[model samples]
Target chain A: AQRVTQPEKLLSVFKGAPVELKCNYSYSGSPELFWYVQYSRQRLQLLLRHISRESIKGFTADLNKGETSFHLKKPFAQEEDSAMYYCAPTPPTNAGKSTFGDGTTLTVKP
Target chain B: SAVISQKPSRDICQRGTSLTIQCQVDSQVTMMFWYRQQPGQSLTLIATANQGSEATYESGFVIDKFPISRPNLTFSTLTVSNMSPEDSSIYLCSGQTGFETQYFGPGTRLLVL
Candidate 1:
C-alpha cells in the first residue's frame, strides 16, 4: 500500500526563522511527490511538485528517492506562511488519486 | 492554471437529509474528483468523477451513499445521501487537464446535525 507520513502534527516557529516540514513515503514504484498548503479561510493549493524542480513562495522540496523522503523547506518564515501543509504522493493505482499525509499545521509567530 | 468553483460553499443540514455539491472548472479538464475531509483528518478521496459515465468510487465508499455525475468536461456533481453526524465533513472537488497536476475548488462545508 502507498502511504505518506508527516511526523509533526503541529509546528511553531518565529518569523524570519527557517522551517522544514518532513515527509516520508512508502511505495514500490517510482513516486510523484507534491506539497499542498491550505491557508486560513482558503482552499487547498499546490505549493510545489518535485517533478517541476522549481521553487514557489520561497518553498522548495527535493525528492530523495534513496531515502523515500520529500521534505518541504523555506529559508525565512513569514506570518503569511502559517497554514496546514500536506505531503501528497501519487500511488501506482492508475486512478489519478493522491494519498495525502496527516498534515502539519504551521504557525509562524511574530 | 485551472480555477475551480464549488456551489453552496457551506451548508448545515439535519440528519437523514442529503446535499448535492457542484463543481465547475474554468477550463476544460480531463479528470474530476471528489474528496472528503473530516474534522482533524486528512483528505480522503471519495471517488473519481468520470465524464459521460458513472463515477469510480474508492474503497469504503459506495454509489448508493455518494452518487456522482459528470456530464461534461468542466462540470460535476457529488450528492451525499443519508446524512448523519458522521457525514459532517468538508467536501472538495478537483480537476486536472493533464495527468500531472490537479487544481482544487473551494470546498463545500457540510454539517449534519
Candidate 2:
C-alpha cells in the first residue's frame, strides 16, 4: 500500500519568518514526490517536484530517501504564501496513481 | 501542465438522487483519474478511467456506487449513484500530463441533503 502523511493540519507563521511543512511517504518502489498548492479561490497547482530539483515561488523541498520525507521550506514567508498545501507521492509502477496527504493549511500573518 | 475543467462546479441534491460530473482536458492525456475529498479527510482515489474501457476502481470503492466512463482521451464522466449524505464530497478529476506530473480540475462540489 502507498501512503502520504502530512503531520501538520495547520501551520501559522509571520511574514519574513521561515516556514516548513512536513510530509512523509511510504511506497514499496521508487516514489515520485510532488508539492501542490491551492491558493484562496484558485485551482490546485503544482508547486514543485523533487525530480525537477528546482524552486517554485521561493519555496523548495528536498526528498530525503533515508528519512522518507519530503519537507517543503521557505526562508522568508510572504503574505501571499497563505494557502492549502498537499503532498502527493505517486507509485511509479501504478498508472499515475497518486496518494495524497491530508493537506496543511498555511497562514501567513502580516 | 494541462488545463482541465469540471462541469457543475457545485450542486445540492436530494438523497437517493444521482449526479453526473463531467471532466474535460485541453490536451489529450494518457491517464485520467477521479478522486473524492470528504469533509476534513485526505483526497482519495476513487478510480482510474481508462480510455475505451471500464474504469478501474480502488479498494473500498465500487462501480455500482460510482460509475465512470471515458470514451476518449480528453473527456470523462463520473456518476454518483444512490447518493446519501455520506456521499457528499468534492469530486475531482485529474489527468497526467507528463511522466509524473498530474494536473487537476477545479472540482465538483456535491452536497447531498
Candidate 3:
C-alpha cells in the first residue's frame, strides 16, 4: 500500500521565518511527488513537482528517496503564504490517480 | 493547464435527496477525476470519469451512490445520491492534461441537512 504522510496538521510561523512542511511516503517503487496549495477562497493549485525540479512562488521540494520524503521548504515565509498544502505521490503507472496526504495548514503570522 | 469550472458553487439539500454536480474544462484533457474533501481533511478520490465508458470508482466509492458520467473529453458530472449530514463536504473536479499536471475547479460545496 502506498501512503503519503504529512505529520504536521497545523504549522505556524512568523513572517520572514523559514518554514518546512514535512511529508513522508511509504511507497516501495519510485514515486513522482508533487505539492499542491490552496489559498483561502481559492481553488487548489499545483505548487511544485519533484520531476520538474523548478521552484514556484519561492517554494521548492526535493525528493529524498533514501528517506522516502519530499518536504516542501521556503526560505522566508510571507503572510500571503498562509494556506493549506497537500503532498501527493503518483506512481508511474498510475499518473492521474494520486494518493494525497493529509494536508498541513500553514499560518504565517504578521 | 486547463481552466476547470464547476456548477452550483454551493448548495444546501435535505437528507435522502440527490445532487448532481457538473464539471467543464476549457480545453481537452486526457483524464478527469472527482474528489471529495471533508471538512478539515484531505481530498479523497471518488472516481475517474472515462470518456465514452463507465467510470472507474475508487475503493469505498460505489457507482450507485455516486454515479459519474463523461460523455466527452472535456465534460463530466457526478451525482451524490441518498444524501446525509455526513455527506456534507466540498466536491472537486479535476482535469489532468497531457503534461500530467492536474488543474482543479472551484469545488461545489454541498451541505446536507
Candidate 4:
C-alpha cells in the first residue's frame, strides 16, 4: 500500500513570500507526481506534473526519487494562490488512478 | 485538456436511497475514474470505469456499493447505492487523456441525511 503524505494541513503566508508545500510518497518505483489545486467553488485543476519539468502558475515541483518526495515550491506567493492543494502520485503504468495526499489549504495574507 | 462535466452538482438524499452521478467528457479519453472526497479529507479513488467492461474498484470500494458504467470513452456514470450518512461526500469524475494529464469535473456534492 503506497501512501502519499502532505504534512501541512494549513499554511499561511504573506503575499510575495516564498512557499513550499511538502509531499512525500512511500512508493519505491518511478511513479508520476502531480500537483492539483482547487479554488473556491472551482473544479480541481492540474497545477503541474513532475514528468513535464515545467512550471505552472509560478509553482514548480521536482521529483526526488532518492527521497521519495516531490515538494511544490514557489518563490513568491500571490493572493490568487490561496486554495486547497493536493499532491497525487500514480503508477507509471496506470496513469488514471492516483493516490492523493491529504490536502494543504494555503492562505495568502495581504 | 479535456472538459469534464457532472450532473446534479449538489444533491441531498435520504438514507437507503441511491444517487447516480453522470460524468461527461467533451472529448474521447483513454481512462475515466471515480473518486470520493470526504469533507476536509483527501480524495479517495473509488473505481476505474472501463468501457464495455466491469469497473475496477479500489480496496474499500465494492461493485455492489458503487456501480459504475462506462458505455464509451466520453461518458460514464457512478451510482452510489443504498446511501447512508457516512456516504456524504463530494464525488468527482476524472478523465485521463492521451497526454496522461487528468482533467476533473466539478464534483457532485452528496449529502445523505
lDDT tens readout by residue for model 2, A1-110: 88788999999999999999999998888888999998877777889989889999999999989999999999999999999999999865436677889999999999
Candidate 4 Cα lDDT to native: 0.92
Q: After superposition, how far is residue A13 of candidate 3 from its true place, in Å?
A: 0.7
Model 4 vs. true fold: TM? 0.95
TM-score of each: 0.95, 0.95, 0.96, 0.95
Ranking according to lDDT, highest score first: 3, 4, 2, 1
lDDT of 4 by residue, A6-108 (tens): 9999999999999999999998567788999999888899999888899898899988888898999999999999999999887776444678899999999
lDDT of each: 0.90, 0.91, 0.93, 0.92
Query: What fraction of native interface contacts does model 1 preserve?
Result: 0.40
CAPRI-wise, candidate 2 is medium
- Superposed by TM-score, candidate 4 places the C-alpha of residue A58 at a distance from the truth, in angstroms, of 1.1
Q: What tens-digit string does per-residue lDDT give for candidate 1 at A1-110?
A: 88899999999999999999999999868867889999988889999988788999999997888999999999999999999999998743345578799999999999
Native A-B contact fraction in model 4? 0.60
Candidate 2 regions with alpha-carbon error over 4 angstroms: B39-41
Model 3 DockQ (Cα-based)? 0.63
Considering only chain A, what is the TM-score of each predicted structure?
A: 0.95, 0.96, 0.96, 0.95
Tens-digit lDDT track for model 3 on B1-113?
A: 79999998999999999999999999999899999998667999999999999999999999999999999999999999999999899999999876667899999999999
List where candidate 1 sits over 4 angstroms from the true fold.
Answer: A91-95
Better of 1 and 3 by TM-score: 3
Top of the candidates by lDDT:
3
What interface RMSD does each of the candidate structures achieve? Answer: 2.7, 2.3, 2.1, 2.0
lDDT of 4 by residue, B1-113 (tens): 89999998999999999999999999998899999987667788899999999999889999999999999999999999999999999999999986667899999999999
